[model samples]
Target chain A: MSTGAVIEFTSISKRFGGVAAVKDLSFTVEPGRVTGFLGPNGAGKTTSLRILLGLVAASSGTATFGGVRYRDLPHPLKTVGAALEAASFHPGRTARDHLGVYAIAAGLPRTRVMEVLTLVGLAAHAAQRVGGYSLGMRQRLGLAYALLGDPGVLVLDEPINGLDPEGIRWIRGFLRDMAAEGRTVLVSSHLLSEVQQSVDDVVIIARGELVHLGPLSSLDTDAAPQTIVESPDREALAAALTAAGITFSIGRTGLLAATGDPALLGHLAFTAGVELSVLHRQKAGLEDSFLALVGGGHTL
Target chain B: MTMFLRSVSAEFAKIFTTRLWWILAIVLFGYIGLLAGGLAALFAGIQTGVISPDAVNTGGGPTDFGSLPPLIYSFASSVGYVFPVLLGALATTGEFRHQTLTPTFLATPRRGLVLGAKTVTLVLIGAGFGVVALAASVGIGGGVLSAFGVDALLQGAETWLLVARTLLAMGLWAAIGVGLGALVPNQVASIVIVLAFTQFVEPLLRLAASFLEVTAKIGNFLPGAASDALVGASVFTMASPAGTAPLDWWQGGLVLLGYALIATVIGYAVSWKRDVT
Candidate 1:
C-alpha cells in the first residue's frame, strides 16, 4: 500500500465578487486516519475541497498535498484522487467507459477499471450507462473513480449524501480499512451525525471559517454535562435546587441542573425533602456540541 | 510527449463512446448527399438541354462543364462544415454542461494540455467527418453527373486536390468549433451562436457584401468565404460578380487558421483557466 500524504490548507481564502466564501481557513489532515471536514450547508466545505484539488483558485494562501501543490504533483491521479461531485459523470457513457477515459489519461492499466468496479461493488453494473444509475449508484461510481488510481490520499465531497443505510455502513468500513492501510482520507459532509461514527478527527467549519478542529471525542468535551430533574411539586424542587446554590433552569420536562452526576441531584433532593419524579444525566451528543459550536439550532 | 499523447488518446475515447458523434455524422452524410446529388441532376440536365434554364430561374448555373465536378464535391466543405463545428462545440460544451471537467482536470491537471488534446482530437474527427461527407457527395453526385453523360472528372488530379483541401478545411472548421466552445463554454449559447451564424447571419452578410467592392474585399475574408476559397469551388461563389475574386487557396487557409488561433487564445485567457467549481 502507498503511504498517505499530509494535506494542509494555510490561510486559504476564496472570494467570489464581494462575498468571501472561505475566509482565512487553515487546517491539516494527517495520514492513517479519516478526517471528517464537517460543516453546515454553505460552510465553504465544497469550496475548500475544490481549492485543495486545484479545481478552484484561492484568493489567498495555499492548499497543498505533502507540501506540493496539487497542480504541480508529477503524478496527480496517483498521488491525490479526488471526487468533487457525485453527479459529475456523462450520462451517455457507461460506467466502464467513464472510468476508462481517466484510466487511459492517467496512464493506468485497463485492468484497474474492473478492479475498482469490483472493489466498489459495481462490477455487475459496469456496462450500464450512468444515466440509468440511481443517486446511490452514482455515489458509488464516484468512489470507484477516486479509487481508480489507488492513490495515497482520497478527497470526497458529500460522498454519503444519497447512500442507502447499507451503502453508508459499507463505506464507513471501507474508509476505516483505507485508513488502516495508512491512506489519508478526507470526507466532507454538512452533518456531523452522518460522519460521526466513521471519522477519527473532525474539522468543523461554519460561515466560511474554522470553528473547531480536533479529535472526535474532543467535541463532546466542550459540551457541559447536565442533569434533568423534575418533581410532582415544581415549587419545592426549584427552591431546593436554588437554595443549594446549584445552577438550574426550568425546561419543559424538568429543571435542568448544570451538574452531570444524577446522584448529587438525587441526594440534594432527598435532603431538601423534595418529592422527586425524574432525575437523569443527559449525555452530550457530538451533534449537540457541533450545533452549539456552529452557533445555531437551525443546523439540526 | 507521452502525457500529451495519452491525453489525446483519452479525448478520442471520450468522443467515440458517445452516440452524438455518429448521429451528427449520419445527418451530415445525408444532408450533403441529397444536396450534391440534386444539384448535379438539375445542372447536368440544364447543360444537356434536357431542361430549359428559364424553367428553374432567369439564368443558369455555371456554363463551364469542367468546373461542375469540383463544385459538387465542394459541398462537402461548403455545406457540411457545420456538423464538425457543432460536434466540436458540443464536445467542449458538454464537459461544462455535465460538469465532467472536474474529473477530467483531476486526471490531467494541466488545463492547457487538456484543451490542446481536445483540439487535436476534434480536428482529426472533423477530418473523419469530411471523409463521410465526401463519400456522400462524390458517390451520389458523381453518379448523377455520369448518368447525364457528363464527364464526372473522378480520375482527375485537380478533383482529388479539391478533396484534399476540403478535408483540411473541415479539420480547421472543427478546430474553430473547439475554439468557439472554449470561448463560450455554455452549451445552449454556443449552439445558438453556431446555428444562428452558420445558417443565417454569415449567409446574409456574404450576400450583402458581394454587391459592394469595398465590402466584398472584406467579405472574402469571412469564415465561410475563406472556406470556399480554400476548397477552390463553391456553388455560392459561382454567383459573385467578376471583379470580386476569391483569395488564393493558401491565403484562405491562413485566414481560417487565424480565426481558430484568435478564438483559442482569447478563450484561454478569458475562461478556460478560470475556476471550474
Candidate 2:
C-alpha cells in the first residue's frame, strides 16, 4: 500500500452558538497511514471532519485536502470520501439506487455500485430501502458511499459506534488494508482504547483543544506493567515510593504506582524484604491515555 | 456538459420514480381536472355560454395566444402556478426530509453546482407540467364545451395562444414552488403553506373582493388574481368579482416572473449561507 494524498489543517477553529467547538487546531494527516482522532464525546472530533469536507464553515482556520479548498476541488468525490457521523440516506431510495445516484453524480460507472455494495456486504439488501437498515447496515452503506468515488482519502467519524464485535473486526482490517494501499485514512472515535489497538497514529483533543498528537507508541510512554498488590505491608511499599518521589495514582483496585524501571522496583523490593503478594509494572493501555486526554467533555 | 446533463437525468429519474412525487403529480393533475369538472358543471347550470371570447391579460400571459375559454385558461393558470412551487419544494425539501443531501453535498462539494442542477430540473419539470396540464385541461374541458354547441372558438389562433399561455403561467408557478421548498426545507411546512395559499386563502380573498373596495384592488396581485389574468378572457382578475386593471398578457406574465425570480434568489441565499450538514 502506498501512502497517498496529504491533508493539512492550519489553525482551524469552529464555533456553535456561544461555544467554541474546535479551537485553533492544527494537524496533518499524511498519506499511507491511519490517523485516529481520539476524544470523549463533544471533543470536536466530528466538527473537524465536517470542516475538512466543507460541510461546516470554519470560524478562523482552513482545512485543505491536498493543498486545495474542498469547494475548489475539481472532483470532490474522487479526492476525498467521507462518512461523517450521520448515516444520511434517502430512506425511501433503495440501496442500489442510492449508490447509483451518487455514482452518476460523480461520473462513475453503474457497475461500481454493485462492487461497493458487495464489498460492504450489502448486496443481499441492495434493493431494500435504507429505513429498514440496522445501524450496522447503515454504517456499511455509509462506507459504501465513501468508497464509491475511490477517493485518495477516507474520513470516518465514530465508525464503530453500533457495530458488533465481528463487524468491528472487519472494519479494523479493512481500514488497515486501505491504509496499506497508501491511502490517507482518518478515523475518529470516542473510544480511544479501540482506536489505539487499531490505529498507528493519533490526534487527541480535550474540551475543544488539542491535548496530544503522536503515534500509538506515545500512549505507552507513561505506561507500566501493573499488578494489584494486597500486601499487609502495602503501606510500607507505598511509603517507600512516596519518599522516592515516585508519583502514583490510587485506583479502586490498588495503589497504582509508576516505576521508572521494573527491575529497579523489584530490586528495591527484594532488598527491603517486602513480601510480594502482587507486583508488576503497570501496562499503559490506549484507553487510559484517551481518558487522560479528554476528561469527559461536559464535566470538564 | 455531459456531467451536468447526467446529473439532471439522474435527478429526473429520482423525482419521477419516487412514489411520493408520482402521488403528488397524480393529485395535482386529478385535483385540477376535478375542479375544472366541478366548474364545468356549475357554469353549465348558470349560463351554458362561453363568457370569455375576447382576449384579456391580467397577470403573466401572452396576449397573442388568442382568446381562450374562461374556465379553460383559469383552471390551467390556477393549477399551473402550483406545480412549480410543489416541484421546487419537493426537490429540496425531499433532501432535507430524507437526509440524502449530505452524501449529495459530499460528493459534489460544490454547493453552487448542486443548486444549479436543481434549478435546471425545476424549470424542465415546470415546462413539462405546463404543456401536459394544458392538454389535459383543454382536452377534458373543451369536450364538455363542444357538447353545449359552443365549439365555434375551439379552433383558430386564440385556441393555440391559450395553450401557450397556460404553459407559461404554470411554469412560473412551479418555479415559485421550488423557491419555497429550498427556503423552508421542510416537507410538512412547505405543503401546508402551498396548500393554504392555493386553496383556502385565495378563495376567501376572491369571495371578499366584491364587498371590500380596497381589498378588491389588492387581491389582483395575489396568486389567484395573477392566475386569473392568464386563465380568463380579460386580465382584470375575472376569477373574483373585483375591480382590477386588465394587465396585458405580457404584463401578467412579467408579474409572475418577478415573483418567481425573487423567490428563487431567496432560496439560493438560504441554502448558500446555511451549514452543509
Candidate 3:
C-alpha cells in the first residue's frame, strides 16, 4: 500500500427533479484507511459516489480529489479508480479487450491490462467474453478495471454484492491490504456485517443525510453495554426496573436495557426479588452501532 | 494530441471487439451486390426486348438504357447507406445501452473529446464501408452487366469519379449517423429513425417532390438528395423534372456537411449538459 490522497466532499447535495437525492452531505475520507460508506437503498450512496466521480453533477457544494476536481485531474485514472457497479461493461467484449479500451484511453500500455486482470484473479478468464461471465466474474472484472490504473484511491460501490463467501473474504482482505499499504479505499455498501469486517472507518448515511461519520470503533460501542436480562417472572423484573427508575424495554426472550455494568443490574434484581435466569452484557458490534445510528433494520 | 490518438485507438478497439460492425459490413456488401446485380440483369433484359424500358422508367429507373450502368453503380451508396448509419448509431448508443459509457467518460472526463474521437474513428471506418460497398457493387454488378452485353464502362474516368463520390457519400452518411446517434442516444429510436427516414420516407418525399415544379427545388436540399447530387449518380436525378438544375456537387457536399455539423453540435450540447448516471 501507498499513502493515498484525501477525498473530500464539502456540503455536497444533489437533486433529481424535485426530489433531494443527497442533501447537504459532507464528509472526508482520509489516507491509509478502508472507509465503509454504509447506507440503505435510496440513501444516496451511489449518487454521492457518482458526483465524486463526475458522472453526475452536484446540485450544490464540491467533491474534490486531493482538493482537485475529478475533471481537472491531469490523469484521472492515475489518481482515483472507481467502480460503481459490476454490470457497467459491454457484454460483447472479452475481459482483456474491455480493459484494453480503458488502458488505451488512460494512455497505459497494454501490459497493464494483464497485470490488473492477474491482480483481480481474472487472468484465466481474460480471453472470455463478459457476456458469459458469472455475476462473481463480472464483479472481479469490475475490480480489475478499477485497479488498472494502480490508483492510490479506490471508490467501489457494493463490490461484494455477487461474490461467494471465499470471494467476499478475498475482497475483504484485498481492501485491507490496499489500505494497509496506505491507499485510500472507500467502499459503499448497504450490508452492515460485510462492511464491518472490511472497513476501519465508516461514514454512514440515512435518507441522504449524514447519520454519523468516524472510525468504526467510535460508534457508541464504548458508551455503555446493553444488558439482556431474562427472568422467570418477566413482569416482576420489568416492574422492578421501572420502580427503581431504571428504564427497560422488552426484547425477544428478555427484558433488554442499557447499563454501565451488569453487576449493578444483577444486585438490583436480587434485592427486588426478581429471580434472574439470564443476565449478560451484550457487546455492541458495528452492526448494532450502525442500526442504532441509522435506525433498526437487519442490515444498514 | 497524443490523448486524442489514444482515445481514437480506443474507439477502434471498441468497434472491432464487437461483432456489430463486421456483421453490418457483410450486410452492406451483400445487399449492394445483390441489388446491383439484379438491376444489371433487368437492364440486360430491357436491352434484349425481354422487358419493356417504359416499364422500368415508370418504376423510378433511368429512361436512357445507356445510363443504367452508372445508375446501378451509384445505387451502391443508396443500397449501402443504412449500414453506415447503423454503424454510427450503434457505436455511441451501444455505450449507453451497455452502461459502458460510465467507464468511458470516467477514463476520459472531457465528454466532447470523447465524442470528437468517435467522429474521427467512424469517418475512416465509414469510408472503409464505402470501399467495401464499391468493390462488391462494381465487381459483381459489372460482371453481370458485361455478361448481359452492356458496356460496363469500368475503365472510364467517370466511373472512377462515381466510385470516389460513392466513398465520400458513404463517409458523409456515417458522419450523419454519428451525429444522429449522439443527438438521440436511445438505440431503438435512433435505429428506427435511420431506417425509416433513409430507406422509405426520404425516398418517397424525393419522388413526390420530383413530380412538382416548386417543391422539386426545395427537395434538392434534402439529405438524401444532397448526397445523391454529391455523388452525381442517384436514380432520382433522372426522375427529377427537367429545367431545374439540382445542387452542384460542391453545394451538395456543403449541405451534407451542414447536417452532420448541426446534428453534432446539438448532440454535443445535450451530452455536455446532461448527466450520464
Candidate 4:
C-alpha cells in the first residue's frame, strides 16, 4: 500500500444563481486516514465533491489532488476513485458490462473489471442488469466502479444511505481497512454517528462553511470537560464560586457548570465549606460536541 | 488516435448492449418494406389495367406508373431518413434519460471528445440503416416490378447511384439526429421535435413554399428538402410543379451537412459546458 495523496481545498466557493452553495471552504484531508465530511442535507457536501471531481466548475478557488488539479491528473482514476452517486449507471447494461465501459475508458484490462466486481461482492450478480439491482446492490456496484483503477484515494458520498445494518457495518470496516492500507478515504454523510467508528478525522461544515476540522480524538480536547457540581445549599455554593473567582454558569438542569481540573473544583468546594450532594466530571461525547458546534435544531 | 478509437468502441458497446438499436432497425425495415410493397402493388395494378389509365394519369407530367425504378429506389432513403434521426436522437438523449452521461463524462472528462465519438458512431449506424432500407426497397420493389413484367431497371448505373446517394443521405440524417440530441438532451422532447419537424412542419413548409418564389428558393435549403435532393428522387419531387427544383446532388449534401454543423456548434455552446449534476 502506497501513501495516498493529500486532498486540498483552498478557499473554494460555489454559487448556483443567487444561492451560495459553498463559500470559502478550505480543508486538507491527510493520507492514511478516514475523514468524515459531515454536514446537513443542504450543506453543499455533494457540490464540493462534484467540484473536486471536475464535474462542476467552481465559482472561485481551486481543489487539488496532491497539489495538482483533478483535470490535470495524468490518470485520474489511478490517482483517485470517486463514487459520488449510486445511480450513475445505465439500467440496461449488466454489472460486468457497466464496469467494462469504465475499465476500457481507463485503459485497464478486462480482468480488473472482474476483480473489482468480486472485491465488491458482486461477482455472483455480474451478469445481472443494473435495472434489476436493489438500492444496496447499486451502491455496491458504485463502489466496484470506484475500485476499478486501484486508486490511492477514495471518495464516497452517502455510501451507506440505502444499506441495511449489516451492509453499513461491512462498509465501515471496509473503509477502515482502506485507510489502514495507507489510502486517503473521504466519506461524506449528514449523519456523523454512522461514520463515528470508521473515521479518524472529522471535518464539520454547516451552511457551506467549515465549522470545525481536526482529529476526532482531539475534537473534545479543545475545551476542558466541565465539572458538574450540585449542592443542597445552592446559594452558598454560588457565593463561594464567585468569591474564589471561579466563574460558573447554571445549566438548565439546575447544576453549576465550571471548566477546570475536577480535583481542583473539589478542593475549592471543600475549602469553601460547601456541602455537595453531587460532583462529577462531565465529558462531552462526539455527538454532543458536533451538535453544539453546528448549533441547535440539527440532529446527529 | 487510440483514445478516440477506444471511445468509439465504448460507444458501439453502449448502443449494442441496449435493445434500442434492434427495435429501431426492425421499425426501419418494416416502414421501408411497407412503402416499397404498397407502391409496387399500386404500380402493378396500373400495369395490369386493374386501375384505368385515366384514373392513374394525374395533372402532373407523365410518370411511368409501373416502369419507374428510380421512384422505388428513392423510397429506400427519402422516406427512410426518420429512423436514423430517431436512432441518433435516442443515442444522445438516452444518456441523459438514464443518467449514464455522468459516468461517461467522468471517464472521458473532455465533453467534446465524447460528443465526437457519439457523432461518428451514430453516422455509421445511420449508414447501416441506409443499407437495410435500400436492400428492402430493392428486394421487394424489384420483385414486384419483375413479377408485373415492368422494367424495374435494377441493373442500371443510375439505379446504383440512387442507392449510393441514399446511403449518404441516411448517414447525414444520423448526424442531424445527433445534433438534435445534443441541442435537446430531453428524450421525449427531442423525439417529439424531430418527429414533428420531419413529419409535419418541414413538409408543410415545403408545400407552402411551393407557391412563393423566394420561400421555395429558401425551402430548398430545408433539411428534408436537401435530404430529398441528396437521394435525387422522391414522391414529393415527382408531384411538385415543374418550375420548382431542389439543389443539385452535391449541393443538397452540403446543405444537410451545414444543418448538422450548425446544430452541433449550437449544442456545444448551450448544453455541453453545463455541469452534469
Candidate 5:
C-alpha cells in the first residue's frame, strides 16, 4: 500500500458571488492518522474538500496534496481518493458499472473494482442498480469508489450520516485500519459526536473559519476544567471557597468550583472545617467544548 | 494519448450502461420507419398513377422520380435528427443531474479532456442512432417504393452517398447536442431548449425565412437547413421556392460544425470551468 501524503490547505478562501463560503482557512492533515473535519451546516466544509480535490476553484490561496496541486498531479486517482458530500452515482447504473467507469478512465485494472467492492462489503450488491440502494449501502459504494485505486489519501464528507449503529461502528474501525496502513484519512461531519471516537485529531471549522486545529485531546485542554463540590453546610462551603479565593457557583447538585483538582478543593474544605459530602473533578465533555469553541448558537 | 482513449472508452461505457440510448434508438427507428414508409408508399402510388395527384392535392405531386430516393433517404437526417440531439443532450445533462461529475472530475482532473471525450463518444453514438434511423427509412421506405413499382434506387451510388451524408449529419447533430447540454447543464432546461428549438423554433424560422430571397440565403445556414443541404435533399425544403438554392454540401457541413464549435467554446469558457459543487 502507498503511504499517505500530507494534505495542506494554505489560506484558502472561496466566494460564491458576494457571499464568502470559505474564508482564509488553513490547515494540514498528517499521514497515519484520521482527522475529523467537524463543522456546522453550511460551514463550507464541503467547499473546502471540493477545492482540495480541484472540484471547486479557490478564490485565493492554494490546496495541495503533499507539495502538488490536485490538478497538477499526474496520477490523481492513484495518489488521492475523494468522495464529496454531494458526489452521487447515476441511478440507472449498477455499482460495478459505476466503478468500472472510473477504473477504466483512470487506467486502473478491472480487478481493482471487485477488490474495492469487497473491501467495502458491497461485493454481493455490486450487480444491483444504485437506485435501489439504501443510504448506508450508497455510503459504502462511495467508499468503494474511493478505494478503487487504492489511493494513499482518502477524503470523505459526512461519511457516517445515514449509517446504522453497526455500520457506524464498522466505519470507525475501518477508518482506523486505513490510517494504520499509513494512509491519511480525513472524514468530515457536522456533529463532532459522530466522529469523536474515530478521530485522533480534529480540524474544526464554523462559519467558514477555522476555530481549532490540533490533537483531539488538546481541545479539552483549552476548556477550563471545573470541580463539582457539595456539602451539608452549603453556606459554609460557599464561604470557605470564597475565603480561599477560589471561584464557585451554586448549581442544582452542588457548588461548581473553578478548580479541576478535586483534591485541592478537599484540602481547602478540610482546612476550613467544612464537612464535604461530595468533591469530584468534572471533566469537560468534548462535545460541550466543541459547541463552546464554535459558539453554541448553531446545531451540530 | 492513452489517457484520452481511456476517457473516451469510459464515456462509451457510461452511455451503454444506461437503457436510454437503446430506448431512444428504438423510438427513432419506429418513428422514422413509419413516416418514411407511409410517405414513400403515398408518393410512389401517385407517381405510378395508382393514386390520383388531384386526390392527394400535393400541388400536381412530385414530378421528379429521380429525386425521390435521395429525398426519402435524407429523412434520417432531415426529420430524425432530433433523436441523436436528444441523446447527446441527455448524456451531458444526466451527469449534472446525478452529480456524477464529482467522480468524473476526480478520475480525470482535466475538464477539457472529459468534455472532449464526451464529444467524441456522443458523435459516434449519434452516428449509431443515424444507422438505426437509416435502417428504418431505407429498409421500409425502399421496400415500399419497390412494391409501388417506383425504382428503389438502392444500388445507385447517389443513394449510398445520401446515406453516408445522413450519418455525418446525425453525428454533427449529436456534437451540437453535447455543446448545447454543456452550455446548459440543467437537465430540464437543456431538454426544453432542444425540444423547443428543434421541434418548434427552428422549423418556424426556417419556414418564415424561405418566403424572402434575402432571408432565404440566410436560412440555408440554419442548422436544420445546413443539415438538409448536407444530405442533399429534404421534404421540408421541397416546399420552398426553387430560386432559393441550398449551399454546397461541404459548406453546409462547415456551417453545422461552426454551430457546434461556438456553443462548445462559449460553454467551456462560461460554465464548464465553473465549480462543479
Candidate 6:
C-alpha cells in the first residue's frame, strides 16, 4: 500500500518495579492490514498497548506513529483511534454522553456522537446509563468512542472480549472491513484462534518477547510436500518402504513417508499388493502454532 | 478543543453524571434547610426573651443582628455541600480503584489537562452549591425571623446589602471547598477532615482561642470564621459561645480565599504530575 498508519516500536522496555513487564520488545505494526497482537496473560500485551498509548512511559526506546509517539501527535484522536479497555466510561453517563465527551475532545462535531453510536449499534440504547449496560454493550460503546473521529489507525486491546457470538462475528467483519479500507488495525486478544482468520499478519509475543511475526499463509504446512501410504498388509508395506530406502513412519492409521510422493507411494503399495486404506496430506491449523507460542498456563 | 478546555469539559461531564454527584446535591439542599431551621429557632428564642436584654443590646439581640447577612449565608450555604467535595476527590482517586485509568489516559493522554479540567469543574460545582445554599439560607432564615416577629431586623439598605454579600460569600465558600477537594483527592480522608474542621475543629479552636484573645484573633483567620464574616456571624472573633477574636471581615475573607487558592494549586500539581491511570 502507498499509505497507512505505520506503528513502529524500537527496543521498547517497560518495568513495573523490578519485574520487567515488557523487556526490550520491538515490532513494526504495518499499514492497511490486520496485525494480530497475540499474547497470553501477563505477557505484556496490555502493558505494551499502554505504552503505545502513552498511559505508561517506557523505560527505554520508543513507539512511534508515522514516526512520532502518540502523545507527540498534533491531534492524537484524529491520528490514532484507540480502544484500550472497554470500561472507560463514567458509570452514570449515558452511552451518548460517553461518546459525546470523546467526540468533543477530538474536536469533532457533536453529531459525530450520534453517528458513531449508530455505527456501533448503540443508537437505540444511547439513552441508557452505562452503569446498566451489558458487557457486550460496553464493548460496543468503547469502539464507538474510539471511532468518534474515525482515525486512520485503530489500536484495540481485547476488543472482542465479553462479546456474544453475534457480537464477535460483527466485530471480526467490521475489523476486516476497516483494514480493507487501507486502514491499519492492530487488535490484541488472549484467543489466538479468534483472530486467526481475521488478521492478515500475525505478531505473537510470549514472555515479553516476539516469538513469531509473519503472514498466515507462510504457515501452510499442507503446501510442504508430504507423502502417505496405506496398506492392508501393514507389516510388509513398512518393511518394503524401508528396503526401498524410503524414510517413513507409522502414522496414526496409515504409514507416512518423506521421500515417496503420494503417487509413488501408491505405486509401491500396489506392487506389494497392500490394499490402500488411507492417504492424505495434513495442514497446520493456527492451534499448532498457538500452543507452540503460548504454553498451558496462559492458553486458557 | 484546546487541550485545556477539552479537559475541563470532560471533567464537568464526569462530575455531572454520577449518583454520588446527585447525592451531594441532595445533601447540600437538605443541609441548607436544616441550617435555616436552626438559625430560625436560635433567633426566635432570642426574640422571645430567652436571652437577657444585655445579650440583645450587643448585636446578639433577637432583632439587632437578627438579619441573615452574607456571613450567615455562608454557614447556611449547604449542610451537605461537603459531600460533593468528597465526590470530586474520590472521582480522581477512584481511577485507581478499577482498571479504568488505562482507558481514560488513552482518551486524553495529557494528564495535566485532565487535572486542570477537574480543578475547574470542582470550582464550578463548589460555586453552584454556594449559590443554592445562599438562596435557601437567606430565604429560610428570613422566613423564620418574620414568622417569629423579627421582620424589622433588616429594615433598611442593610438588608439588601446582606443579600448581595450573602451571595458573594456563598460563592467564596464554594471556592474554599473546591480548594479542599483538590488538596485532598481521597474521598474519606478529605470529607472527614473538611467536615471535622468545619464542625468540631474550627468550633473548638475558636472556643479555645477566645479564652486567649490574641489566639482568638488568630483563629478568626480560619476558613469558617472568614466565611462567617461574609455570611452571618463568626464564632472565632465574636462574643458568641464559639470564640472571640478581633478580626475584621475583610481579613477573614482574604484568609479563606488564600486557603482555597493554595489547596487548588496543590491539588492540580499532585494530579498533573503523578500517574492517574
lDDT of each: 0.92, 0.73, 0.86, 0.85, 0.90, 0.70
Scored by DockQ, the top model is 1
For each candidate, the DockQ is 0.86, 0.53, 0.81, 0.55, 0.80, 0.41
- On lDDT, the leading prediction is 1
Model 6 spans > 4 angstroms off:
A1-3, A218-268, A294-297, B50-72, B77-84, B94-104, B152-226, B229-232, B235-254, B257-272
Expressed as tens digits, the lDDT of each residue in A49-159 for candidate 5 is 999999999999999999899999888889998777534999999999999999999999999998999998999999999999998999999988888888999999999
- Candidate 5: stretches off by over 4 Å: A229-255, A264-279, B59-66
TM-score of chain B of 5: 0.97
Query: Over 4 Å off in model 4, which ranges?
Result: A1-3, A221-283, B47-50, B54-67
Restricting to chain A, the TM-score for each candidate equals 0.91, 0.86, 0.86, 0.81, 0.89, 0.86
Fnat per model, in the order given?
Answer: 0.87, 0.70, 0.89, 0.54, 0.93, 0.37
When 2 and 4 are scored with lDDT, the better candidate is: 4
DockQ of 4: 0.55
TM-score of each: 0.95, 0.86, 0.92, 0.89, 0.94, 0.84
Error of 4 at A34 (Å): 1.2
Instruction: For candidate 2, write residues B1-277 as lDDT tens digits.
Output: 7667767766775676556655656666776677655555444433443444232232553323223355554565665466667777777788878777778777676666676677777777777777656655666666665565545266677777767777777777777777777778779999999888777887777667755767766665666666556544532344444455645677667887787778778877886447765
Instruction: Tell me the alpha-carbon RMSD of every candidate.
Output: 2.0, 5.5, 3.0, 3.9, 2.3, 4.4
Ranked candidates, highest TM-score first? 1, 5, 3, 4, 2, 6
lDDT of 3 at B127: 87
> Which CAPRI category fits model 5?
medium
lDDT of 6 at B237: 32
Against the correct fold, how does model 4 do in TM-score?
0.89
Location of the lowest summed lDDT over 10 successive residues in candidate 4 chain A: A252-261
The superposed Cα distance between candidate 2 and the true structure at residue A93, in angstroms, equals 1.0
